[model samples]
Target: MRHAVVIIHGIGEQKPMDTLRGFVSSVTRNQGTDGKNIEFYSKPDELSNLFELRRLTTASAEDEGRVKTDFFEYYWAYNVRDTKVQQVLTWIWQILFRWPWSLPKRIRPFHIAIWFIIFASLALILSGYDIPFMGEDQPMWIGAIGTLLTAMLSYLFTGYVGDAARYTSPSPGNIAERQKIRKDGIMLLKSLHESNKYEKIILVGHSLGAIIGYDIIRNLWSEYNTKYVDGKYKDQLLKFEKDYAQPENVALNIKPYQSAQEDLLYQQNDGGNPWRITHFITLGSPLTHASFLLAKNISELKERMKERELPKSPPVFEVIKNINRFTYLPDFKKPGRVLHHSAPFACTQWINVYYENDYVGGNLSEYFGKGIREHKIKIKGSPWLRFVPFLSHTHYWSDDGNLKRCEASLAILTSIIWDKKMPEKDEKEKQTVQPDANELAGLEL
Candidate 1:
């Protein structure tokens, strides 16, 4: 069976296939001296239909019935257009104007440097003596430097930061922008599923793309939530969920939870269900600060989750026995239990990886759910460097010689994407996903 890797890129003026190419390059090049020699081939992107957006197809071991993966990018930067300076200004007002006490605790310390930058920029702008090419009092060198700095800042504010501001804002225009992105994402997934080529779809979202990925899964799962085939094998999956929903078992290991999720996913597929996305992996994701980015506070974020607007890991469980966080539709044509709209994570396992020093990414299990396997790692740094950012967000993969954190991150990713082979009826399958140790072992935070 072939697997599809749909990677959603972060903010910025990212072109089609820009992220997928870089990501595929890193994944392939870092396979270590041991492991399968995977080769990548550029194939036609059927979904995008754009020459710039080619699919990265890897040569898989089809002879041995080994699952191969195809990588596709969900490019949505085109939807965020005509980003006005007013949008950035408004977002700055919303974020910089807030007091430390009002900000979320996790994001509070991170905003100190942001506040300093804001004040420093204001000081420079308000100071008439520091005018760029507009004022006569400024020296030629000062004016030249000021003009260059203006151009740089303009690009940063409009292109890079504008994406987050436009998407996260609740304004009517922002809502429309978000809707378009989500609709396009849903369409892409639907097309992939309908193609009937992939048995599984793995979503890898980086930075702001993580937020988009979460929205896509939460929304798309509703279309297939109630779908089921008549079968007597549903009780096992149901019992697993019921037992997992207990308060005592809330702090359980993620491996067992992930394994159960993988089982339930294939069961749905075997029963003719169309939902095939089994794993969602986020790297350097900003969703770690949901309260600051998505809502006003922590209470509102949890409220949204409880209201079924946001999907949670170990989804919101009910006290009822048979309908443990699921909808029991007795009046349907063929009566069976169906997953609730907010229970996408009940089947799709969320695996988040972030550098310890990355200000944008942090532990998400506390906010999203307990079932999320949040891996905090350190990459090419001294132990005391955890307090610094040092552009760690951009260096998730091993771009340099340091494969310390990259190995650990790739281990989790490879383990999930490669997946475990299914057992046959005659004899139990002993084949397991054994990625190279050199490619999958490293220090953890």
Candidate 2:
């Protein structure tokens, strides 16, 4: 069987090949698979002329079948082009007003105390000169030089921070970008269908990319249902067959009911959509933040609010409760009534993997209902540790110690990717795998 896998990168400045190469290399190496068997391509001919992609074709280590994976970078960093000075101001505003980082309220006093200490030290350095904010007359160069230096440093750090905030937020600007990402994903899937004879489609997204993947899959599923499974074209199909029947065989051939009934049975028993997604995998995804991200859409927000009976923004709890999961048709007393059921299995199976120390990761099974599964890998620190979010968030694809440490968890992901079934765990279910920090701390693509 042939398979097409689409991988989407999370927040930050991303290069197509850079992200793909790192991920594929790391996963394969950790799985004890040979990287030499894989072929990588940049800007493959299968996609749109203007669209960029990093494509790879590799034989599955567990099977004789071959798999092709495409990496999509929905890079939004290019949209931001603030001047150095502007970036400095934006950084100040975000730090003071937005306070993007999550920290314990108990530690707030210490942070404030540290701020005062820094301020006092700076004042002491320029003692003889009066600071304007302090009601002292100081040389213009003192302030000018300080401002310029701050701006320069901010400019250097502006690219990732600013775009990450925008990409993760539910503000108007970010919503527009989200829509564009979803539309582009749809186009890519369409192109893949026209160009290849793939039997399975799998979508994998990391971090914020996972949320984007959800939007794309939801939209495509809706489109597929509308076009094929809704019974809208049944009349047209029967009409065409009736009109084409010969006079002598008209009575016998007019058995359009039997033909249509068989066709409907085929659709219901098997997956009705030819281009359906077989699986959706999310790595270290902050999908629990969906409510916060969708706050800007009033119509959708209103529906969510109404469903949850909430007066204000839908909380994470409410959003999770409202999540719609795919399910197979329930059993009925009469087999004939079930014969025309359109979907025999869930539209897609969701597999989510996250490290315990990752702040952005949450159990998505609670949201997507029965079809979703969550796997938590052990990390060095408390999963909710506040200070090291950056490190924990980005190292999910490390090739060495961390990957090896979480071997059991990674096995689940590898099983899905290689089209193999995972071995059943023991009743107690505890396994020992230790992640090495040195190998995972600085991953290079």
Candidate 3:
């Protein structure tokens, strides 16, 4: 079956295709020689790829049965730039002092350190600090002016790229902005899946992008359940969508979810939701910091814990619930595969990869509950480098010709996405898939 992967990048002033190219390089290096083993096709619109299966060779065979993989980069940093500066200023303030209060004890120090750096740098700049015998022996006031300009530029940089500023803010506008981005991402996935080009889908999100990815999956499945599984907002949504969702000149790839089981069944067996998320991969994610940067006040995590409620990490809980909602049936009409009863969860698996020293990365297993896979790789770097919060955070999946970290991380990631596992005769069975061609692709595109 064909596979599609969506890559969501974290906060940054990113150039188009920069993240995509780097990611492709990393995965390519890890897989084998670049152009020979992993060929990447850059598309005119957005997505690009050609992840070759080791066993699949000839051009026609590769296109027909091999694991054909495509990559799409979900970009939203540009949207944040258009937001009001006042909102960003408020976010800067919260990030400096208030946000740390909401962080877990383990990660609070990193947050605190980051806060100190921001304010301290600004203070030092404002104080007119100057290098010895430099800048044409500029006046102290001139230094201050230069620093002030620098500070403004820095603020703009952080505001534009620091997705956390928008994501974690309590402002309704910021929240709405984030929701819009997630909606766009979800719609993209819907089209990609409905194109009937991919059977298994995997989403890879890094840093704040992981949080965005989490929301997309969480909301996409929730919407699907409401319209397809539970059958709540069916006809109204369908009728409204026909008039509003599609543009006059454009064609809609995915149809509205139908209320009837027969409709959903037909869509599935026929071509409705042919693809499902087989795996979700997170690298250097700040998912654990969600309640702090994502909520209005003390966050739902603390509220639930204090109130003796579910005590859920909202994103993780939603992901688990959605992944477990339904299973993909490759051959629905087959005698044994047909008539499989509906189950509580879907079959999507999550693979979270983090480094011990990553300032923004934290363990998700405690929040992910049992039966979830979590991987931690030892980062080989100068001991002093770990102290640089942002550097360490971004290095997890970066491929600057450094193969160790990328190779280590991709080893586990590839295993989850491309490994082979036999189908269970029934839903009650639990099995580990082999980390080979058979596990995932079955050499089938």
List candidate 2 segments past 4 Å from native: 30-45, 48-52, 60-157, 168-176, 230-271, 296-345, 366-370, 380-387, 399-402, 405-409, 421-445
lDDT of 1 by residue, 322-344 (tens): 34445454345663556677788
lDDT of 3 at 47: 27
Q: All candidates' TM-scores?
A: 0.85, 0.58, 0.64
Ranking the candidates on TM-score from highest down gives: 1, 3, 2
Identify the superior model by TM-score, candidate 2 or candidate 3: 3
- Candidate 1: where is the Cα deviation over 4 Å? 30-36, 63-65, 113-138, 229-231, 321-324, 330-333, 381-390, 398-405, 420-445
Q: Is candidate 1 or candidate 3 better by lDDT?
A: 1
Per-residue lDDT of candidate 2, residues 1-445 (tens digit) = 4567777777665664566666666555534445343444554545633345546665443453445554444433344444244544453354344232332232334446666787898888778775355445667778898899977666555655555455555456457755666787778777665565565667888887787776676555544543334333333322322222222222322133333323332343243345446667888887644433444333555465445332110011211223221121223321211111122113355677887656566665433333356677765434443245446666666544355444555566667766543222231123212234353232111
Candidate 3 Cα outliers beyond 4 Å, as residue runs: 30-36, 44-66, 83-86, 95-102, 111-149, 152-162, 226-275, 296-299, 302-346, 384-387, 420-445
Among all candidates shown, the one with the greatest TM-score:
1
Any idea how many clashes model 1 has?
Answer: 0
Candidate whose lDDT is highest: 1
Error in Å for residue 362 of model 3: 1.0
Error of 3 at 177 (Å): 2.6
lDDT of 3 by residue, 343-405 (tens): 111234456788777757776645433323567776666765545545667765555767564
